[model samples]
Target: MTSTQRTSFPRQGVRETAIAVKTRFQSASDVLSDCLEEIARCEDKIHAFNLVLDNQARQRASEIDDLIARGIDPGPLAGVPVALKDNICTREIATTCSSKMLERWIPPYNATVVAKLQDAGAVIVGKTNMDEFAMGSSTENSAFGPTRNPCNLDYVPGGSSGGSAASVAAGFVCCALGSDTGGSIRQPASLCGVVGVKPTYGRVSRYGLIAFASSLDQIGPLCVNVGDAALICEVIGGYDPRDSTSIDEPFSGLLDSCDKGVDGIRVGVVTELLAPASPDVQAAFTKCTDKLAAIGAKVDEISIPELSYGLAAYYLIAPAEASSNLARYDGVRYGLRVAGQDVESMMRATRSAGFGPEVKRRIMLGTYALSSGYYDAYYGQAQRVRTLITKAFGRAYESFDVLLSPTSPTVAFGFGAKQDPLDMYNSDIATIASNLAGHPAMSVPFGLGANNLPVGVQVMAPTLGEAVMFQVGAQIEGLAQ
Candidate 1:
């Protein structure tokens, strides 16, 4: 038997696009041109990117075509176009984290994952907008502007990885990179109707990712399909000497596992996580689990009460880390310096002028939590709760190969729907537990909910369980079709 010979460029999907370009069935330049054309057509309305690398992407595409002409393989991602969440450093490219503080800051080096993408022949399209310092659940916190959901322009794409998910949903790129802190990646992927992966905390290197919450952040892929997400994860995952937290393990065969299905696997539906979901989302989740069971998987409902504490713990821990990480942005160093009489006043003025409301709110919350008398009551307690959640998840995994839940409690809501900060924070409830547990999790678009907006069903696995996670995600994706 022989594989099908492609004669035209694949309109989507990372694997097909890369194979089509690498096998000489499609030109890298042509693929890039199509992406650029799409960007020009709708980017104004979508506002998905902070900066689009038109010339650089064109030049890179040409270089890949040249490599293929010379009979050298350009690597797996051959000519697939990819977007990066602005928080991921890209050497000379400005990495703003969608915040005014670092609006003009350019790194001297690329993130480990960025370099990996280039090595895999993925063209760099642009940097996508995100919540200011990944502090919000909606892209509305962006200093530049909010990214609207591609599924329905009136609604928001979830954040702080909103723009990355929007880019994939809008067909601006084959896939995009997003850093998941709390529910940044998965929640947005759910809202945007795309596939988003949050690999085990250390499964992918965080060396060049501008830290929001050092311990909770993980860089992952936002793609149109599970297969593309798996391929990108495989390309970017594995040990990195530069990242102290990077897992010392080889990451491969993930793409191969996509077709393996979930037959005979033990799947658990997290009861507490599902309790808060909207009826529409609950319905979609029910369908997702039923599909899994019908496919020969052993599916059952399981309660992990400790997950209820995840939201409170994440808020305290992530912000405490953010308060420390963002300290370098003071006027004494670089970016958005506000003039004042002295260094002390200048630093205060600069932070006041540079940070958005949401960023300031989190910073204050973090500072207060870490303050002299409150550390034990707030930050320390949060860390203890994190340990509890991690242990609870470990115990659940002992009985189930994977856990299931709705990625977000509701479908993408209209802009300004969650003006109150607490309301905004609640959006991440279902997804935060995975970040807390340092486990692998993914959100695969299951079906539509209220107003025909997309709903995502989350598949979570124990640490280093990406292969099984992808397998279940693929099965759910198949059901959606």
Candidate 2:
């Protein structure tokens, strides 16, 4: 394993870096070189990157510099180096998803978000590591190896977007794109002490994201702060014709509304979240609410009874979808294939050999749930629970502008602390509800806890209320500073 215990890298700002490049205050080439230099310094210790497209990054930077010399505006994210979670397609770039199944497979097209980022002038730095096909909470399930926390190398970075969060926290890049299914993005961002956002289902196009659970999967941004997150959200969010599930609404004024504090905003503290969080995490959350209250926000406790059933439903529903989605990865189409007597035998051999243990476990669980005899008892019932969860959120939103909770029950834990699947499942307890309800939620770094690891305070909004979420998140960030 690489030595991940180095001192935390000073984070870079997405907006500031873009501004610097746009104004010629710093050349794009110089900025990218600095990023590469920083990556070189910590890449060994962090192992955050799965593939570093150094030459491509340099060439892109040079092109941006030339555009600037001609007095032409590139885009909002101009010249900013951004990391992408490996599951996202990147044209010919390798997007392994940190799994051996796709280790040798390269996509022929860019994911919608990748195209948007490139169109907006953000330089694609490289593809960061991730949990295999966005499975597992710790990222330890990755076939390539685990991504360690930058805060303390002994600990694991939260995942499956661990490397994306680690890259930002390690200062390898200003911002990175991560797809959230359950707590994939927020949990890791909380552990890494950065901003992580999961837009409402359909708020961002999921056309190119390799599906973990089609209903729960939403791609969002992990960045240094709320401002950066809001900026990226605005840039990538909107309707996409290719995505049938996409909402036609555009995410307007995110950057403008993002800095607004929670003054007079009605923030609800989820009643159930208190029990699952550690005392230290509870203390951090209390302090954050107190700070918001002191700043004139009205904070109150609200009950979302259905939230208690979230985890149980999520495991069943997500896996059921995952089993269906993963069915396409059989030996016939692409990725890894092991020799066998014939087609059926070959498909069986490939999947058995290619999928990691965690993935296989889920596949089996999902397949069993979707089986004729158990479908209604498991999968059907789980969807009903999801509807109830969504209704609970809707009721809460009637009285509260945004909801708050600890992003995770505790902070970044040691690698082997939660080996059992049940133990690992606890990590996403605070985040699964929002995914179930298809609501926008974010994890904002609140402060350091007694363990010295970062504690994140989650802010959730109603289906298209990202503006409200970011505004409240900004207030939480203010408390931390």
Candidate 3:
């Protein structure tokens, strides 16, 4: 496709073809072609996708066309092309998790969310890049190379869902799936000027998604707007028997509540969380709060003292779990494995060569924290802190329907500035608390910052309260316009 043919869609949202497909005016193949053409035009600059599933997407789109021809309903998202984070498994596509360790590994089964989207007639365009093993806040840590922000190429795309965020922002896909562990989904969504939702932990099944910090990781959608995110979440969110961590509750009314404005809703502005944010971010967040107030919702600045330690506690707990979960990639089973003279040597060789710097750092930290001599001092203390943070959110939720804050302290930063692992991990400071509290949180574009990059206001609700979140998010989305 020529540049003119590829750049046909407006930069603000999903392509016209994709919108037509969703509205039932065109076949899935037509929408898929538009997205593919865009990807071909911009992938080199954005580095959004690690692998583009052109053949499979085309074949799936054809199947949807056949269904339409037969007078069979393909569902609301029929013909829409969406991208998946590399960590989410697909039947034949390589789910690398943005690590060389699994560069060529193809999952035999699909993640519950991926299967759900496919069943809804959405085409899986490809798997996008991510931080290695979802270990970093900037996509710069991807084994495949960093995914640059579409808004500003010099800056990092908030990760580990940076690829998904960038792709959606650049209009390469209608929507994308991203897994949030810490601020992976929300932060990237913030930076890329998209809507990213991190559902209450366990609300979305984790059956085929590569585990990062199991308790903290939840898969969600990155889309052009709140409505699209709600639609995608409704299709993916539900109980899954295969996932022990999946909740057995009825589906949260996220989609049903999107049209319900946040009138009379109590939105709490977490004072502690906002205090540390940059001036620009704070200003934008305050503006969003004021907008909410004007809309007839009660807004209050609430204090949550325990939130101060959220980042420290998350680092400990996440890595401890990561160390245990990543043990399966020792090269003896699936993924890249270099043969050594003996088992131990082979394992050491494979890990040392396959894993990236950030991955190794976290693995080492996790192993050390979980070790017998240091477990109590590090992992145990972190768990205690986690409990305190959860309690803090619970206490706040008692008086507020939802908690609001800046998703990240600032907008996207220069790629190389966060090379230090410790500095990079701090990027998730504001978002980790929600994950620790097991609450649903969303990042919606609030305003542009001093750098002209987007700033996102995070709306978080109590566990299993996604309906409340969607209601609030929809109101914010409107105000943002």
Candidate 4:
């Protein structure tokens, strides 16, 4: 059927329909096809999708149609189109993490997050690109190439979840899943002008996601709006027996809190974040704070002195964990293999040849940090700093219901502008502390910046305090509108 004709068909959630036959007015196939067509139209410019599951998506749509015809409910997200970060496993799709090492590997099983989305009747539209092993701040580090910012092609979409953010920003999908180890999700969402949430660590199971830093990694929703993010989180979150770190606590009323409003809420503006941000970002944040005050929220400045050390500490700790977690991909066990005379040589050659420059840089830094001579100087010191930062957050949370900061220090930059590795790493400075503290944080589009690109205001709450985060985020979202 023609794209125009298919789009004209009546639509229902994938799970809502039970018949396989396409109706005169509407069908699941129609909705899926239209979305696919939209993706085709813009994906070239955005470079968001790594692999488009055209056939598989069509088949799922047909199945949903049959189910609806049978009068069976497909469930909340049934047939809804959702894109997944390439780092997240999908049965036969290549979950590359935008790295050469796993370029040809297909996961044998779906990740926990992917499974939940599937159960909800969501169609996997495609795998989105990301920084190799989720190690960099810009999508330019991806083996596949960078994902362009939808708002301005010359600028970035943010990373390591850059592709996922761009896909949603470009309207390629209603929502997408991105893994955030240290600001990956929130940074990109902010850059792309979309809603992105980084759930408290352990809130979402990390079973099949390619590990960056196991302790800090989280899978969350990137969507067009806060409500969409909340909806997707409801479907993918909750305890998982398979993930030991997964909290056993019942699902928190995250969605319900969205409508609760932020009246009488205590919002803390971190003074450290304000000083370093560009004037535009600072102004945007100030305007947001004013809006909160107008809405009856008590806005106050709170200090987290230790947060200034977050970026340095996170770089050390995350890479240390990542070096260990990624060690398993040696030539013999799995992934790309390099033939050599001995086992050691084979493993060395494979890794050296497969991993991207950014990944290698991190692995080397991590190895050096964890190495015998420097362990105390690097990794140990970073851990101690982390403890201090965490404590500072704890103290701040005690005084304030939520903490607010500009999601990024600056607006999106040109793809390769931050060529210096250290410069790129610093891009995550403002958003990394929440990851260290394992708190729920979200990025909401607050206003336009110097380049006319979107600027985001990040709202963070104490551990497992997503309900409060949502309330504050919803308030900010309302103000932005």
Candidate 5:
């Protein structure tokens, strides 16, 4: 039997492969073949993808080879194999958010980012799993089942973007797209030992994304390293007329910005962010911060008191938006619908059968929060708190070029270790503040912590500050290595 373990695969990532493909050092077909083989070897064990489009990937590779045969450059991400989170639609593909409701639902068009990736010659392997409607922190909530961490099969690969991060760490794909509503991307990236980013709101178009929280959701990349993350970000990010939230910002040359170094940069270590983290994580965080100082960065502990309420605010705000956005799935149109005596009954039956426990829980919580007489007490207060968090982030950035903290409170935990929902919510405590603030934040793998599982240090920058954020990340990555 072929070994199911994924010990190693091609070290050359998105950047190296693009260079090799262009120079004839490696044909796109040959490179894709190697990637496919690795995916075959690992997917069964890791459960990284909701679907593996082997034939489609192979066909795309041939097309890229044809372009190279005619001496044409297929843009920056040439021939790179990428995995997209299932929530990000691809034309004619099942854009299920790992929910049974849309299990057979296919999208008529690709998301703006998907189109961008295809245009740049990226070979999309398949759609990775995600939480139902982008809710939940662990992949466990997926109606399709959980994505096991490649680092420890018994543990979850942090979630709702668990499969996206797992695919990169397991070598199933070089990069993957995932949306962050809270710490969906960064927390999972930390657990799975990869670079995961939540770009500033509006930085990446959400036209193709199935919404969970319109105000908080932002699509970003999970990659093997900081430079790969930067490359993927530049490719999929830009202004899009289709998405009302798409900002008119030039996203050129993010890779060039990565090497700017951290010398003389100011980094504020948020004290409150660290207080919730486990001791093992705190130690790893200190080492990473030390590396920044050694490289001439000015590091200091800063307090953002308002940030303490961020997770509470996010739980209210995100679910409220989710309840509203998800209302479209009321069995009146597309997705799974069960027959009933009348339309209302059919709709109620379909939703009851379609949604998982976590999703239903949030919908109820959100509906209650948005209901009359309770809005101000819950959802309204949450929005006010969100504003304070945003201002708090701004206040920190005033004295610092970037803020730093442990991406998660602990390393990947065993399935069911966090049985209580409250316990699971703490997993994202360190990373949620930025999402609530609509600022860009990323999780950079620093080193191993408990059980030798990876620990990631989060670097959050001001709005439109991804360039400098990546620059510091590249530096931290160098030290960790």
Candidate 6:
């Protein structure tokens, strides 16, 4: 389906829909019905949701309608339907991480973002699928099954947040929340053709996100457009005492920032990030830069060579952290546990049976990296490389307001096209640098690329620079329109 074709489903965006619902132009229930109807119509083909909370969502909508009748505003979201990636804990709802180990494990508490969404009057629709333990570039790593791209059912929606991106692209929801560790959010948003944000590491609370790599992991929004993404970010962002890494400052007025045009903004087109991109992707990027230049922004090509080591550094650091975080899933505590002749045997049996091949592979890689003999040569060196990348970004920011690149090296590929692990790992080459630097990054759908599939232009900002990042993203979005 072409970009024009998708307009039939979502019909309107977050702000418009919220206003209509709030002003009695439409009831919250009516908006939710449309969402559920759309999910029912295409979910079988798209497989965007792991669980659809129809009865629960309807109940919430009814409550919002009651609030409106009482002359009390629900909040900013005002009855907007939203989906949560399976990895984000939603009290009593299964947070599977698309892995069999946690298939039936219901989180006892809602994640910080989940609570924030509810407070904003957003109705929780359901949990979306992902790469098992958030480990693969394609949703194929999911133990449940692969989530096909809504744009082209034959193609893989980029992962490990593929289902969240697909849900928005398929019009299953107006917005969804996803976690980004490396390129999980942006790459999938690019491939699936939507807006995805990865806020600065601590800008949003991470209190209940199932850890993939604690240091690198961040919860963010995936939406149909930039305005909605910004609103959701503001709603879910802010300091949370529960999260030690949470930023102490306020994160409001982001929606307003979207309207601030990119005039005089210094936009850097990263030469290194663009080098590995496919010709179609590069062409689309060139057009994006040209559009920015036409709009009175200073667009110029710049090189950040230290970013070349991002993928290698990310592979080591993220896995080492994963090995530590995942160690808690032993047979004694929660999740699937198989009995054995002894404690040691039981632990081995449970892990071997519980984790998928990809998850196990990452676990092994992480364990080895952190091992006594290789710590300094591998994991320690990777940390040092991460510092270099961070410092390089700092210097680049001194001269550039924001950096630009293709969100993914190529558009969404067919399922099973990248069977080799290294090929799949390379999928995040253009996006990993932002995570390493703990910077803000987002993917804005610019236009279609090879095979007429959608392509995304990435906008990156320094730590706490989300406001300006959205400004650029909104401009790119407007150019596409």
| Winning model by lDDT | 6
**Model 1: residues with Cα > 4 Å off, grouped in runs:** 1-11
Residue range 129-154, candidate 3, lDDT tens digits: 99999988888889888998888777
Q: Write one digit per residue (lDDT tens) for candidate 6, span 1-481.
A: 5432333234467788799989999999999999999888788778888899999999999999999999999999998989999999989888899988998899999999999999999999999999998899889999999998888887899999999999888888889899999989999999998999999999989998999999989999999999999989999999999999998988988888989999999999999999999999999989999989999999998999999999999999988999899998888989989899999889888899999998998999999999999999999999999999999999999999999999999999999999898899999998999999899999999989998888999999999999999999999999998
TM-score of each: 0.97, 0.98, 0.96, 0.94, 0.98, 0.98
TM-score of 2: 0.98
Per-residue lDDT of 168 in model 6: 87
Q: Write the per-residue lDDT of candidate 2 for residues 147-180, one digit (tens) a residue.
A: 8888888888899999999999999899999999
**For model 1, how does the per-residue alpha-carbon lDDT over 1-481 read when each residue is reduced to its tens digit?**
2121111121489988998998888899999999999888788888999999999999999999999999999999999999999999999999999988898787889999999999988899999999999888889999999997777788899999999998988888999999999889999999988999999989999989999999999999999899889889999998999999988988988888889977799999999999999999999889888988998999999999999899999999988999999999897766889998988999999999999998888889999999999999999999999999999998999999999999999999988999889899999999999998899999999989998888999999999999899888898999999
- Per-residue lDDT tens digits for candidate 5, residues 332-423, read 87999988899899999999999998889899999999999999999999999988888878878889999999999999998888889889
Q: Clash number for model 5?
A: 0
lDDT of 4 by residue, 204-239 (tens): 999998898988999999987787688788889999
lDDT of 5 at 232: 87
lDDT of 3 at 480: 92
> What C-alpha lDDT, on a 0 to 100 scale, does residue 66 get in candidate 2?
97
CA displacement after TM-score superposition, residue 299 of candidate 4 (Å): 0.4
Off by over 4 Å in 6: 1-11
- lDDT for model 5: 0.89
Query: Positional deviation of 372 in candidate 1, in angstroms?
Result: 1.4
